[model samples]
Target: MEYKWIDNFIDGLIDVYGTKDIYELYDSLEISIRKLPKCNILLQGNEAFYNRNFLNKEVVFIRDDLNMEYEKFILCHELGHAIIHTNIITSAFSRNLLNLNKLEKQANYFALKLMDLNMDEIAFEGFTIEQIANSFNLPVKCLKLLLDSKNQNI
Candidate 1:
């Protein structure tokens, strides 16, 4: 379950694209982004999804109701599937399971690394993980996953 490769992949992408800005990365990679209303049942209560159409064009559909910060994280998560999962179509729905599957963890890790939040540095400055998550408008669970991954040296 080690995911250092995800970090490496993101690093290579940053090196090639010259930016960690998710929107900029999507633009440079020719990925289309669409915003959908919360009433859209197509998502099945998910926040977002990623897929390649019959024409093989990559696209991400996000819920327009999310706040700016959460929206960015959702976009980054879907972009993870676009880059990491590649051929696999994926969604960002809530899973009731305690343990996340590999793909979900990988996508979450990708979102964390892509954001380049410097969590360790921030933690060094005396901020609790919850506080950090709140300041960044990220879910505490997601931030905890990132911290756990780092703790494991992954």
Candidate 2:
């Protein structure tokens, strides 16, 4: 799907926030982020989630078990939902498939854009998907999502 709107929205965020750091972006948006403690549910494969708390405050919860890089990507993904799908609660689980739905794809694209990675530039430099994924410390499937969406006219 063409997501030029999402691209523009992310660019607007970067222009306004002056940074692409997920933590800083969340802070600037007044969204609270929490780290979930290790538990049975977390062990059952929940990676992260975003929701409006009882106070109607936006909040993102990421599992503590993830590596720093993965955690950052997860945060960015949830932030996507918070900004792009404000009325919807979203979650990321290890078991979830990529490209599962329009919403998921939007969040994935948002995460990629928010990271400020120039896919065309990277590809022009002769980097393979695995190499890019390894270099960025991101999951292979996440990079695959980016690759799949690359030719979709933004």
Candidate 3:
């Protein structure tokens, strides 16, 4: 089946949710995922999850023991999968990118799009990838690739 593109998904969500800031979007997802439903179980695990038929749902697995940016990124990435790949109706990727090439790309693209970052600001603002990553408190490699892709697009 032909997949519905992620841009369309985000556009629709934006229309319903109004224009939310990038961090706010992340924060909202963070809030929603943290409060896992008991029986309805939109999220099934703290490590990760993907519902083939579910429109948009994911678990970030942010337990108290995991206190790190990488842990935070897990939530972001799971949200990315939900937002970008839900229509595919199945997933075959591991948490590590080495096993799942396509999900890795999709997740990164969704993350950057959700951040609402662009090349003009990133290139002209004199902020290095590290600076941007630091400001966002995200992993540097993630920011680096996102900025690089934006540069290539420009």
Candidate 4:
């Protein structure tokens, strides 16, 4: 089933924050929930405990120990789940390792939406990397990388 939360988030950002761009919305989300502790453990290929979960809880547990973009994305990915996918996730599903479920997919989709963007001149006139950097307040490189990759997906 389609997650309306994602669309709701976009619409709410547009309505309340007056934000029409994806990165700007994500940056707004980051600003709204900015104090999430950064902590990361790379169990990526290990697959032992690839991630953690808090059902219906909007919290971010970023593994700051690792500095890789993937870890950052993982943190944001979990945040995406918390924001957009937790409502549909069932109690039984939350109990075990069903890492590749639909909710997880939706979370990944949210992450992808947040990360992938195109800053066109008509859309973002006089929008420079420096301005985007200032707006999101992320490093130019990080923001640029996120904006550049429009073909990636969950």
* TM-score winner: 1
Tens digit per residue, CA lDDT, model 4, 1-154: 4545675664564688675453354466552222223332433332112222335323343433544445445545555665555344535565575555655556655554555444565766778878865554345655544554443421
Winner on lDDT between 1 and 3 is: 1
Extract clashing residue pairs from model 1.
Answer: none
lDDT (0 to 1) per candidate: 0.82, 0.78, 0.56, 0.49
Which parts of model 3 have CA positions greater than 4 angstroms off?
1-4, 19-32, 35-59, 65-74, 87-99, 118-128
Clashes of 1: 0
- As a TM-score, model 4 comes out at 0.41
What tens-digit string does per-residue lDDT give for candidate 2 at 1-154?
A: 6888998889899999999999899999999977877574643467877776737787776788888877888889888887887655335653264344878778978998788666557454877768878877787877887877775655
Task: Point out the higher-scoring one by TM-score: 3 or 4.
Answer: 3
Superposed Cα deviation of residue 59, candidate 2 (Å): 1.0
**TM-score, cand. 2 vs. native:** 0.77
Q: Give the per-residue lDDT digits (tens) of candidate 3, residues 1-154.
A: 1223765766776787675454466566543445333333434444444443333543343344443544455555666776666555443363433436667666766666655654457354877767777766676877876766655762
Ranking by TM-score: 1, 2, 3, 4
TM-score of candidate 1 to 2 decimals: 0.82
Q: TM-score, each model? A: 0.82, 0.77, 0.54, 0.41
Rank candidates by lDDT, best first.
1, 2, 3, 4
True-vs-predicted CA distance for residue 106, candidate 3, Å: 1.2
Cα error, residue 113 of model 4, in Å, equals 0.7
